[model samples]
Target: MTAKRSKVAPRVATGGGALVPLPVGLSEKEAAQEAYRRLDRRVHARLGAAVGGVSVIGLAQAWGDWASHLALSPGKQMELVWKASRKWQRLAGALGRDPDSE
Candidate 1:
């Protein structure tokens, strides 16, 4: 038995490269700087989400563990704090990238 294939022709333009955005009224240097700023903000947003997620998970896990034990678990709690601090440090590093420098 032979199978038939359907053909589609409307997905792409007939003759053109992918579109590139042109910055109106901005010099190339300014456009590059603006693009860098956008990229930096996007990175920061992603890093912020990661930091928040890790912080929440660490806190919830530690709280649940402590609730189950009901005694002092400073060691585990401190460990969670340390991990959260590390995540914050990662976010800080991401924030340290300068969009205007180079």
Candidate 2:
């Protein structure tokens, strides 16, 4: 008879040197948002490079086009930020308490 070997999972290291388990039960929207946030970082870096390589007039035109395309006035953007912050605040509050906590 031959002996069988067991398979092991890869370990992820945390800042405290502990092997923290991966998060579970994220909804589709949450997963998409996480992906978008990562993409946003990369896109922002590329935008910075593009802006630096272009002339001032080109940069200004690009900025104007982006603002118009998004159709977000400064006031509306601020309002959106406020609403997102409040939504996250509520989510954090809900997560902080145990499911059985009263």
Candidate 3:
């Protein structure tokens, strides 16, 4: 006798180009693993969206600044100033800085 496969369709689509169905008739461990996998994918998706939004907003602001500067200086070129910040003072030791100095 041949084993029969269920004809139910998947309820969710995953980023890895596949459909993920609800875990049914699975043991406690198996169900928990499946839930964790779905949660991980969701977290990654949200993070990607946040990073993309920040990137787009930064580009838009930079472009606006460039346009305003160009308009104000018709013939002269605009000078750019690069600013650096040390936000990881606490993590300096982890980044190869001397503990005593930190």
Per-prediction TM-score: 0.31, 0.32, 0.32
- The all-Cα superposition gives candidate 2 an RMSD in Å to the true structure of 20.2
lDDT of 2 by residue, 1-102 (tens): 533322333233543567633234444455445556655766666777867756657778998998896685787788889999999999999999999868
lDDT over C-alpha atoms for residue 31 of model 1: 57
Candidate 3 residues lying further than 4 Å off, grouped into runs, are: 1-21, 53-102
Candidates' RMSD to native: 19.3, 20.2, 11.6
**lDDT digits (tens) for residues 1-102 of candidate 3:** 534333443345566667677655555555556767897978767876977746655777999998898879845542322111234543563778666885
Off by over 4 Å in 2: 1-72
Candidate lDDT values, in order: 0.63, 0.65, 0.62
Model 3: number of backbone collisions? 0
Residue-pair clashes per candidate? 0, 0, 0
Model 3 Cα shift for residue 92 (angstroms): 34
lDDT of candidate model 1 versus the reference: 0.63
Per-residue CA lDDT of model 1 for 6-86, tens digit only, reads 232212111244434534555555556666776676666786687774665577799899687745777778888899999
